[model samples]
Target: MTGAAERMRDRQMTDGMALNPAGPDLAEAMPPGVLREIEPRHLEEPRGRYHGHAGLLAAPHNVEEVAAVVRACAAARIGIVPLGGGTGLVGGQIMQDGPLPLLLSLERMHAVRDVYPQENVMIAEAGVTLQSARDAAKDSDRLFPLSLASQGSAQIGGVLSTNAGGVNALRYGTARALCLGIEAVLPDGSIMHDLKRLRKDNTGYDLRDLLIGAEGSLGIITAASLRLVPPPAANGVALIVVPDPAAALDLLSLAGRQLGDCVTAFELISGQGPRFQMEKMPDLRQPFDSAPDWMVLIEIGLPRGLEPDTALEALFEAAAEAGLALDGLIAQSGQQAADFWRLREEIPEANRLIGAISSHDISLPLSEVPGFIEDAGAMLADMGNMRINCFGHLGDGNLHYNVFPAKGRDRAEYDDIRKRIQASVHEMVVARGGSFSAEHGVGRLKVADLERWGDPARLQAMRAIKAALDPLGIMNPGAVLA
Candidate 1:
């Protein structure tokens, strides 16, 4: 079907509530092993904030099988919600109120297709866990630098689909930068086999880039050719206590001046995070006897000849001399380094236990971060009595700005202003030239935010592209766009 006729048919389909795979036809058309019953895990999101609806489940073993499933759904006029690792925070994998859709799970397609150590490339299936992809790269003596706390469960497809940014993004960039190419099943049931290992392919249009961060709205990504780097000869991690947020920025600048790209990851951590951990997780080991107002977790990787310990120690000394650092603890062993990272990684879990009134994943220009933190804290103070935990990828300008109710009070007490708090914070972030959704994609959670703050021209172009690509409106309906 061509343009006008296709759009008209789409309109007709939308005039009434869309139907999911109902009678025997959808099941008969699907491959033998593709169909399965929906599970409780599939319907519930991580945060329990969104409960999705799916009439059927389909797990494709290969790209062709994926295309077949897409064809079946298209023929049946069924919306498709592609489920990744389910580690997404923004409710992108969820479809709550739309027509009963087909849940497309890529878990069965897990495979490390190819690895070229000489060329620093690894072809990985979308269903492969991020840790598995990293292991494959390690087996080939190359480093796939995309690192996230949820690596054990987060799949490559969702990571790329969300264009995820993690601790190492300051050095390695996002999932999009680590990827060279992708193979996806377009909305019309045809496969885009563009997973090339080339570094420079001047194709007319970059469909790979479009699909990477589209949150599966564009298509279902089947696999990717990922970029890899040579492993560093030495690595070290340190927790440097800064008196305040501005000092943390100064410390970052000093590290750049002294160590340059050797700094692999730099995370800002608020004392509130450790306080939460101590209150909720008593068994958690802490690096300091008392948590300072703010600290930065810095990891450095260096080539041969330079000792990581000496480099970190020298950097700390310089920072202390410059009045940017108060106290520090450098990891003496691999286990100690893991413990340091464990503390940072478990902050989110601690927050979950305490229960936040509202949480924001935001980013500001490096210069504005400290001021924003101060201003936003004061603004929240005016809005209500609460505690604020501000932490995240300090090197990359992203912060996990979260709000918690006052001590001994339940989060439900602030339910009246929950949405107001979120909006107020996002407004401040937007006014400061910062993004309210930093690494998290605009899933169902932030549809209104995108509409309110999104540039008109960009929204128009996005809608036009969505209409052009998936006129049937089956690919991840109501995600990234309303």
Candidate 2:
């Protein structure tokens, strides 16, 4: 299994067979109390797109146990699929059609190791939920701006592993940018203790960044030193109706001109979003009397002396004068701000309830966004009778462009054309120099997409690194690579 020939053959069989079966040998090698019974949740992903098989479930209590479990799995040649919150949409946590991997769950490692307020850093275990991390930061009067709707369940390890980009990405950046260091176990079960709290280190080869978004292919991130920001003195939210995607983009430019870094988040919402919410989630209140064709949700954070509402009103007036804004609402209170955000955050869940024939998390150049949306919508309409819910962090060019069946039709009926729809969308995205997989890492779902659209030299280097680190190809088989 260590030879080059064996490695090449193993890559071919990553989704086909296990190199070696480790039913009893792996069991005997596990640390006591580390081998728990596999649960249904560990094998299921958020979108119900992938279901995996687990020969063993190892819930390591700490990094030492985590290393030991990895070492044992390496010895047995058993593929190891690291499990965190299991909230990933792209099936990174699941290993369908591969070897019955050892499911490595870090839920037991949930602990905020330390918080150094002076350094503006928090050292937290991989299993700690994002909500818990945020709560800890708040206790010290700081802010953890890396947010997601799944924050209540998405663990820190998976967040960094995926290098997630939430709404605040316009201001705070992605998970990779926010992380200072990490404590991880390499594929060979050796630990890399690079979890330093310092902001700058010019060390050789930055493996911390390598593992951050590797999607558990290179190694397991057991813990991290995450960067935290100071809470803004004043904050405001506004929902401004734009005539179209073009106007929304223009409004974004205007907001940038006026607010600069104070503009924390700028989200684009299609009218389909509010309609879907009304149809599926009847109890959740709508922000507008009627669903506008398009709108932009803006949030600004200012220094102590500035008034957020005043700033927003002035910005809206400028936008109206420029003919970029039709109507808008500035949050008068904190509850109203939360409600505005709720309208933006709940779109994904509503889309899920309605079921999607095809979903894309794609990103493009800022200027290309409006054009891509309009062209994509026209193309999709010609393809089939489908509804589009195109929305996401517009400030960052990441769009959760999802397609659903038309009214009174089930998504199951569109199965035949689903593959074509995804391929067409990705083709357009790549032709325009956009990425098929944006914030979400390339899990089992997008491996083919990666192979098709991935840059040749970059993909070669990635494969070389994978082979060098994981010679046996046992870490998350059939993921990230072929």
RMSD of each: 3.6, 2.9
Q: Give per-model TM-scores.
A: 0.96, 0.97
Clashes of each: 0, 0
The runs of at least 3 residues in candidate 1 whose Cα sits more than 4 Å from the true structure, single-residue gaps closed, are 1-24
Error of 1 at 99 (Å): 1.4
Model 2 spans with C-alpha error above 4 angstroms: 1-18
Worst 10 residues of 1 by lDDT: 1-10
Model 2 residue 263 distance off true place after TM-score fit, in angstroms: 0.8
For model 1 the TM-score comes to 0.96
Query: Per-residue CA lDDT of candidate 1, range 246-343, in tens?
Result: 99999999999999988899999999999999999999999888888899999999999999999999999999998999999999999999999999
Question: Candidate 2 — what's its lDDT?
Answer: 0.90
